[model samples]
Target: MTDKETYQRFIDWFRRTWWDLPESVHLHPMIETYLTPEEVDLLTNIPHSSQGIEEIARTKGMAPETLEPRLRALANRGMIYESSREGSVRYRLNDSFFAMLRAALWPGRTDEATKNSAPHINRYFLDGWMDQYAEVHLKGLRALPIDRTIEDKREIMPHEDVVHVVDDKKYFCVTTCPCRHRHNLDPDMPDCPHPTEVCLHFDELAHYIVNNGLGREITREETRDILKKAADSGLVHGVSNWKDGVDTICNCCSCCCMWFESFHKLGHSASMDASNYRIQVRPETCKACALCVKRCPVDALQLRVSPQARNKFGKAAVLDPDRCIGCGVCSHKCPSQSLRLVPKDQAELTEPPRDPREYMKHYLADRKAAAAKNQNTAD
Candidate 1:
């Protein structure tokens, strides 16, 4: 009824979607800062599923031309998704994770509202909101090993190989890393030194992003170049936790990545599931440069005394297998080539769900079970 109630209702609507806000972040400042009473009111009329302008206009009880501009404005603001296929245009509300966070900032918008929301979004993630994602045993993302870091090429699956993942797509694009972009926007936050424009999208997702001006279309070779630059910067390759139809590959740094920061700063139990591979160390050949130790995002590697080590310090990188995510950032930069990712013991390996269909089935089941558990505890 009131403006406050209208905004709260919009927040409530997002809760029913794939990503629910944690209880502590019910009215997140970042959400409040960008959204307005008028925007919230208009968004309520938009459907979750895509529909044509005429169809939406009928629902609004207005002329199609009258309603089109409003819908286009929301789409431009990243509050809605728009697509054009075969001369027809359609629109739908973007999911909260994208609308409020990823897509909202990925375009590197310099507008006042976007800049103001940055610090609040960064604070929300760091404070407690990220724990909701970690509560589910099924992670949304999995580490993809860097190229040339696998110990045995024969063991690499198409999904596990970054090059194959890129090759599988017909379209490619690059966008600013929302995580790093957020931190870089906030003057109070520590400056993130890693490359920011390395978030890669492919296929239909790439089409949507580029069409919406969220990112720029790039050649596959350019995409690979971005991947190479990310690896050189000690960034981990993170992709959707699925075996097929993976749409995104985020070049994540421990300092600003949502998943990595959730694990490293918020003390979440886990950020992402490890790849099927784990680092294999050759202590005898280890130069003990400690690059791997420094590069490991998960604190998985440490330099310790090793009689077998050939380096001056008599210390070599030792892995806490439990902590390694098999991301290969460490191995990619190994000067002595003493570290490489090898297939985990078959019994310990985890293959991601076959595709988005299977992945969401498992994800929804986990969410439902977690909700039930929390309700029972409350009772």
Candidate 2:
């Protein structure tokens, strides 16, 4: 096949994974930017299931020694996952979703390849790639409310509490924020002013990242410190949208976060699922500082004149419930303690799925249903 056809073949293989690239989207720029024709050829033939080099090399009709370097190169580039067990090593092709995006940029490569690919990746995301999640209720991540920012701590669940989520983890690691890193690398995109190395991971995921040279290991104390710094800088703590075994916490900013960009720029319903909590305004003590209004990532809080206003401006923050993600970024910086996270009304709350598998199931089903509905309307 021609080089273009070879890359197309590789792109088609991504369909076998959980994320199916929309038919209307052309990813050739992204695919060609980071991957060489030879690398694409090798990836096209590799098995998705994990296997030892001896087994996989035999399939490619090359000696294990000959194929080992190629596989290692791919693993280093985040095209494949490398794992070791019982002193034995194995490899597997990465999926199109997290592995494709996270693995591609998490290491924070500033090389030309990464830089050139940034615009292509960013463009594709805006050009219908994220539309797939427009109707999916179970998003890939959810906001984790800042510690001590909740109105009533007694009502907070383990999953919703940022402190509890961090305490539950045994291992900790930090990596570059892929979302910000990608945009920062792109000359055409505006730089994200927030720090890049604020992404956190735990347990087996942390080990994998450290072992792969994708991130650095840190202590639990450092993890908390980083979270604190992120909160102080107006970053939202976003975790996987599941109740258990949460692998990651992204310090997200509205300017460069994949989810936020999708919501704010692309006009999606939400960047991710709002936490079970929502921000409650104490207008009486608001001071009319408008700090919360300025810090809110989602424009959820706006200043308005009200009878409850007591400050000089005669304006207090009012919440647009539909826009709040309950991230508590606004409340964390509130000078007068006028903003706090409160449990959403029972009728408005939606629990996250039990785990990643369940999240994927619900997400795919909803996306499929949305696609069908759109198709019907078009017809």
Models 1 onward score TM values of 0.94, 0.95
Over 1-379, each residue of candidate 1 has an lDDT whose tens digit, in order, gives 9877887777777666777676556355777788878888778767888999998888768899888888787776778898888989999888877776788877888788899888888877766566667567778789999988887988688899998999889999999999898889899989899999999998878888887788899999999999999999999999989987899999999998988888888887887878989999999999988889889999999999999988889999999999999999999989998998989988997779999999988888887887899999999
Give per-candidate clash totals: 0, 0
Per-residue accuracy of model 2 over 1-379 as CA lDDT, tens digit each: 8998998888888667767777644478887888899888888867888899999988889899999888887777778888888999998888866665788788998888888888888888888877778888777889999886888998778888888899999999999998998899877888888888999999977887887778889999999999999999999999988988999999999899888898899998888778988889988889988778778889998999989988988889999998999989999988898888889888987888898888888988997899899999999
The Cα local distance difference test for each model comes to 0.86, 0.86
Clashes of 2: 0
Task: Count backbone overlaps in model 1.
Answer: 0
Q: After superposition, how far is residue 164 of candidate 2 from its true place, in Å?
A: 1.7
State how far residue 189 of model 1 sits from its true place (Å).
Answer: 1.4
